[model samples]
Structures are given as structure tokens and as C-alpha cells.
Target: MEGNDLQRDGVARVLLWGAVLLAVAAGMRYGLLENGLLPRDCLAPGSPVAPCAFKTALVQSFLHQRLGWVSLVLGGLAFATAGRRLAWAGWLSGLSGLILYSYEPAAVGAMLALLVLARPRGEQRH
Candidate 1:
């Protein structure tokens, strides 16, 4: 039916968006950071270069497991509420956290987000 098609479309969109986010995160973590494409001086304090500043910000985000905690919190909220937006946010955050060296809580968060996302559209509503 039309409703089923709509549901499928929504799910597909969410999945596609998540995939794109994951790919970008992987590129930033591996191609740039792990691959050492970024010079060490790029991360130094008070870097004047714009690109270095952006890269440094990305690097700092994963430090101290901050991304993992953020992913966990967002995933928990999405699980508790089953809101589409929250679920998408949690899924994206989880994927990024996992790729950026925050796998522990990120794994749990990703699982929670997947669970919410897998539920039937009708059941997603409170």
C-alpha cells in the first residue's frame, strides 16, 4: 500500500544518510588521521591554517571518549522515544564514534539505534 511504500522510503533515506555519514567518518579517521596525511604540526595549538584548524577540531572530538559518550546518550534518547530524528542522529553519531576510536559505547549506541530503526513504522509512534 501507499503507507508501506512511504515507510520503506523513509527507512531507505535514513539508511542512505547513515551510510554517507559513516563513509565520511571513515575517510576522516583513516584516510586523513590514521594515514598520517595530516602533518603533526597541523594539530599544534594556535594553528593559523584553516584546514588544520578544522582537522584539529575533528581530532579533538574523539579524544577522552567524548564522541562515544555523546553517541550513547543520543542512542539512549532515541531508544526511549523512538523519534525518527533522534534515531538518525544517534545512528550517525554511533557510526562516527565507532570509526574514530570510540567503539565501546559506540557499539551499544549503534545497536540501540538499529533496534529503533528496525521497528515497524506504526509501532514507532508513542
Candidate 2:
């Protein structure tokens, strides 16, 4: 029973983290990237505007699909090693990438992470 409870708690935490990351990614996409003044202000070279550099970096990351690749890698690691921490990392990155315009690999990574996460704790190798 205690083990079951621990598993439930771990699952809940993973879900909560995914939700929070999704929310943040959504906010970044819709709030700052799409319909916000940041992009416009960032057009000027060396704008020195607050958040301009940060937004640009994020945009670059999105364009390059860095998050999606990282998530996929982490998911593969988790799947190969059955490591709980790696699974959590994959899940979080997958959720973020899904929201940040990296859906293809993100979906596969998220599926792998979920599979690892769903395993019983006792059955997990790590």
C-alpha cells in the first residue's frame, strides 16, 4: 500500500510538472511570441530593450527545435535505462517542446516518457 501511495504521489508530481511547463510554453508562444510587442520592439538591432534578447533566444531555440531533440534524447535514455529522473526530464521537455512548436519528436518523446513513468516502481530498474 505504501509503495502504491508513493507511486501515485510520483505520478501526481509528474502530471503537475507537465501541466506547469505546458502553461509556461503556451504563455511564451501566445503571449510573447505571437501577439505581443516584444517581437516588434526586437526588430531594431541592439534594441537594449528588456526581454528582447531573451525573447530572441527563445525564438531561435524554437526555430532550431532544440527542445524537441533534447526531449527525444532524454526519453530515449529513460527508456533504455529505466531511470526515473531521466523519465521526468523527458516528460517535462516533451511537454514544453509540444507547446513550443516542436510537436513531431516531442510527441514520440512524451509517449516514451509516459511509458517509463507508468511502470510500477518495483519494476523500474532505477
Candidate 3:
């Protein structure tokens, strides 16, 4: 039972850290784009950034600019706590990150972290 708990905790740690790394990467990309180091319309088909383009500049800008920070905090909280409510919150945060930036790795890591945290202990299995 102790070993199982330890393993679960280890898994949780990995998930949390992975989420943080992904968040950081996403944030870095945002920073680059904002600074003009990278083209903002790279995701768009043509230049001049048409307002109706897929995932319009406005929406993409909002999501890309903010989701990373939100995910970072939520993922860190999920890592530090084991409460069920917090786990759910982490799931929500991850989903938002996924939607806003389509950052699968960060979102998936956060969701998995929540799952691990929310799982019943081995003692409860019986």
C-alpha cells in the first residue's frame, strides 16, 4: 500500500511538471509572437490577417496570450494539492488550455494529473 501511494505520488509529480513545461513553451511562443519575432498570421492562410480567418486574430491573440499563465497556476495547484475539488479545477484549466491554444501536451498532462489525484487510494479498492 505504501509503495502504491508513493508510485501514485510520483506519477502526479510527473504530470504536474510536464504541464508546467508545456505551459512555459506556449508562453514562450506567445512572447515571441507579441514581440514580432514571429509572424502572428503564421496560422492564417494569407497575410494582412483577415478578421474572418480560421481562429481569427482576436480570438487567437486572447487565448494564446493568457491561457499559458492560467494553465501554469492551475497545474501547479493541482500538483500541490490532493483534494477532489482541486482535481476537477485542474481538469477545467487543462481543458481551457487545450481549447485556447490547442496545446495537447500541457492539457493532457494536467488532465492526467487530475485523474491521478482524484483516483481512490489502494486501501479503498477493497
Candidate 4:
């Protein structure tokens, strides 16, 4: 399959913007938690500080931090190259964002974007 430069550039932009948005969202979430603008535990009764148990919170925090970084890196690479193979990597990274970080919407959006960006095999320009 042969893809044109315009198609590649458009897909790359989508992936790049999606990646940037995901990173920004993660950072904003962290900032909100740090400043107490958002409650740590939504399940807890009113305004309790750090209501979540130590172990669960720790694991979740670790996962989110790691997945967020991984997603950013993968997204950046996809944006830089826009290779057809990188679409697969982007899908996996987006899945990690969904599973590990609980960023369902952004992860899903990235997944869809990657899917659209992937060029089909055996396609002919003519």
C-alpha cells in the first residue's frame, strides 16, 4: 500500500495533538490532587484527606505516572515518524493509558486516531 505525504502529515498531526492533550490532562490531574482542588477519594464521605488506603493509592499512583510517561513517548515517536507500524504501538500505548491510568476517553480517542492512521496493506494508488 502506498500513502501520500498529505495523508501522512495529517495523521501525524492528529497523533501529536492527541499525545499532547493526554500529557496535559495527566499533569492537570496531578496538579489538582496536589493542591487539594480535587478530592483524593471520591468515595469518601466529606472532604476527607487521602481517604484511599495506602496500598491501592500507591499502586494506582505508580501506574498512572508510568503509563503517562510511556504514552507520551510513544505518541511523540508516532508523531515524528508517522510510520504505518507505529500505529500498532500507538494502539498498545493507548490501551495502557486506559488500563493503567484510568484515562478512558483520551486513551480511546488515541486508539481511534491510530486506527485511522494505519495504512492498509496491498492498497494501490491507481
The model with the greatest TM-score is 2
Clashing pairs for predicted structure model 2, backbone only: none
State the lDDT of candidate 3 residue by residue for 1-126, as single tens digits.
355453664556545654775576556446544456445555556654443453354356445435545554566665565454555555655654664564554465466556646464543433
CA deviation > 4 Å runs, candidate 3: 2-62, 102-105, 121-126
- Measured against the true structure, the TM-scores of the candidates, in listed sequence, are 0.81, 0.83, 0.38, 0.36
- C-alpha positional error of residue 93 in candidate 4 after TM-score superposition, expressed in Å: 2.1
Q: Between the candidate structures 1 and 4, which one is better when assessed by TM-score?
A: 1
Clash totals, every prediction: 0, 0, 0, 0
Candidate 3 weakest lDDT stretch, 10 residues? 49-58
Task: Encode model 2's per-residue lDDT on 1-126: one tens digit a residue.
Answer: 245454454777777778888899999888877877575666778876668878877877768788888889999999998887899989988998999988889888887988788777766353
| Best-matching candidate per lDDT | 2
lDDT for each residue of candidate 1 in 9-43, tens digit (9 for 90 to 100): 46777678778988999899889887877666864
Predict model 4's lDDT versus the native.
0.52
- Overall lDDT per candidate, in order of appearance: 0.80, 0.81, 0.53, 0.52
**Superior candidate under lDDT, 1 versus 2:** 2
